[model samples]
Target chain A: MDYFFFIDLIQSTVDGLLFGTTYALIGIGFTLIFGVMRKLNLAYGAAALAGTYIGLVVFLMFDAHPALVFLASALGSGLIGLVVYLCCFRFTPSNYPMASLLASVGMLLFIDEVVIHASHGLPYPYPSVFRDAIIELGDVWVRGDLLFVFFMCVVAMAALFWLLYRTPLGLATRAVSQQPRAAQLCGIDVTRVNMMTFGIAGVLGGIAGAMTAAAVGVLSPVIAMGLTVKGLIVVVIGGLGSIPGAIIGGLLVGAAENIFLLLRGVTERDIYVMLLLFIFLTLRPGGLFGSAQTRD
Target chain B: MLEIADIKTSYGKIAALKGVSLDIHDGGLTCLLGPNGAGKTTLIWTIAGILKAQAGSMKIDSEEILGLKPHQIVSKGIVTVPENRLVFPDMSVRDNLIAGAFSRRKEKGGIEGDLEDVLTRFPRLRERSEQMAGTLSGGEQQMLAVGRALMARPKILLMDEPSTGLAPIIVEEIFEIIGGLRDEGRTIFLVEQNAHMALKYADRFYLLEQGRVTFSGEPGAVDHDEVIQRAYLGARKAS
Candidate 1:
């Protein structure tokens, strides 16, 4: 094999790994809420897309710094999450799981349409936080934007793990996740824990949205369907409620898709990814780290 | 001490407790004896704040406690070991015990000490501390539930049918533990269908029939044979 070909392979691997970080961030958002409430916010991807729109609007109108734009966008998405919780989840009868899921699906379409109407079907230019070019390694190069997004994702994951395993709030959240009735009996405010969990997930998703926009340098309504499908695939692949599983699953899906694209082209890439998902669902429904039994 | 007065609770239109009243003094075990569907669990739920009383009041140490959330009631130091021992099945036995003390904001060291004490009291729990609670046997789960409640350091522990579904030997062992808890000066409000064990361990007992308290007195005052017959057959022998 040519030395340059080997370098290209290493570069693509790094690129896949870097892109996988964003997927992991999105997966964590899904897993966080699912872990505690056992409810999937199907609109999660839409929420992130909505956040990107917010950042774009702020950057255009106020000429805000990238950091402020990201914060503003996250706040907007967080509010959307709160609304989703109230409208879609809060009042739905607890026993009606199907109804809740349908409501979330409805929410996804509703938000997507709103974004499309607002943006008038045009792809909006998104502001980048970093101005550096790709760093070269032999024949391989890593984009600065992708590297930053990867670092952000790692930091966010670390923070989430700390919040979940190290703090008192995390303990309370875990208690409610395990046994809502018992948690209530122990005087833990179950509703508050649920709200906070959703909020944190929304914030992470918002950051993910901004970082994704920065990575790609553009935002469009078209990305909603693809991102939503990808996020769902990640959630299923990672197991419904396992954090570590989400991270691993996201990376696996990212790298596997890249390798498939290299070997079989884009048309067959999703086919292989979907096949991987189907295989996991049939053989190891719990994902890699998920417990054998499904939790309610 | 706890006082429940004229509490009325219902499932839709059907009333479970209709203006029922009871009192439990401090530092003694009081058993509520009733047949199936006699509103025993309903009353327990109401007192524990899981079910709201439609009419009437509940007071703990003279503080009005009706309508408080279950956790709020727990913060006031009243904890219930619910029927069926609804332990967190997927969680470890240790996690279940930790969950019992969730209402407290105290020293970790002290909580650990209390955990150790509970483990010592229920050696079976110690043996299975790392095991998932769902894997424990019925008898061991009962012990785990009671042990979990004890970790709360509750001022009043409401236990519902702690001996239900246990073997006779396990039942005796559980009653012995209950007797020990009573001796340790914990205020216990027990709901039991097991008249023999209730009479053996409770300082006072209440008999609820058709959602009304038909009998309340010291165990010795109630004729053992009559109470047993009433509990099982819902009738008294014609003299």
Candidate 2:
């Protein structure tokens, strides 16, 4: 009822919206891979974390520019993504979908442990141009790093959309996603297309990882677990394989989390978010934009 | 010419195609007529490299191709129009046709020219080129599937039950298209349950039952009713 509370709510929503860009990027990656593979890569967050760590390594060793660090992260994550595809998805027979699913979960833990061991369980400062800067817009203040992340996410998503809708490679990827057999008959190598999908998703994950780390100004293994949870929540809330659904879901979850944090404090915040997920699952399992097809 | 010899394929332990051998002559419309579960679709899939044969040889002009992947087989200029018209449902008709040219992506001019050719061949597709493939009528989807396969510039086209689930009038139209393709000197292997229609355009016919070829010869060598009866009912026991 207080005027200050209304202003706080608006500011929190703005903050959440900007922060949600990281989740949106991660969600887009998940949806892209799921769209092609029809299987969840549970290692996605850990893979992104590994990429961020690589970026931090480059920063420490070469004292690279922030742009170089981001590029390194994307490349490192893309390589790891190919490896994950070979181990977790490629050799496994598709008829046994659970095999790939469990393999990815195993990969998640394996990569997390590797990062923890390498970093000695310590948090590193991630380089960013606007780590401590802020901008004032009317009565609300927006973090400069969050704004930067939002800008980069928008650019990346635009590029991704162009790749999917306009390029020949995009056509093949979409064809494989829609009907793999038909695509194969059209002379598409299904395995090659799938590997490319994972690589692209990995690249997106890397950027999301760097953006999140830069926004927080810290890189730690602990971030990976939370990110994995948040990414899955975003995917489910948005739609399993829908790109637009992922972006909208990410923003919704972000805004919801901030409001819940304001209303119920940090401890109780996630409970309400989980409750929202539950409501979606029960009432609209297809998600915001998912088709009515059953996942299994 | 495509030669398949002693090809065996299985679904887990159950065999779908067992030691099947057949030859598709150059510039001929060869139709495989069979009843439900007669392994007609299985043979089409096997030839397309969608299903791997456990043993045997498939040769395109004496070059063994049995172990090759689907895309590799497609590069050899064999394209398939799968049953149920498996066009990319969410994509526009133009995109679907473009996707068919995926193997030949490096040939920009050929693709553009082929796009024009396919659109001209199927004008209904041109009218709805921007429409989502899933929204097209069943006959249109079949036409799209055929056109999509054609976009690959296939030397040999394999069509599986293109008439399945289409209206009666639509089936005749599709056969007319098949006849047109035959007249153009394109080699075709069609798997169909519509024996009467297939027989009309088929230069050669193979009747398959339970994964083996029960009968095969030029269409003029057999009675139309006899081939239709043999397709539905199993070969009348040696009597």
Highest TM-score among the candidates is held by which one?
A: 2
True contacts kept of 1: 0.64
Q: What is residue B157's positional error in candidate 1, in angstroms?
A: 0.8
RMSD of each: 3.1, 1.4
Q: What's chain A's TM-score in each predicted model? A: 0.94, 0.97
* Candidate 1 error regions (>4 Å): A1-10, A129-140, A290-296, B89-95, B106-141, B165-167, B233-239
**Candidate 1, A28-105: lDDT as tens digits:** 888878777778889888988887788789999998888888887777777777888887888887777888889999
Q: For candidate 2, write residues A1-296 as lDDT tens digits.
A: 99889889998899889889889889998888988888899999899889888889999999999999999998888889899999999999898999999999999999999999999999998987686788988788888888998998888899899999888888889998888889889999889989999899898899989998888788887989878888988988998898999999999998999999998999999999999999988998889897745421
What fraction of the correct interface contacts does each predicted structure contain? 0.64, 0.96
CAPRI category for model 2:
medium
> Candidate 2: misplaced stretches above 4 Å?
A292-296
Give the DockQ (2 decimals) of all models: 0.56, 0.77
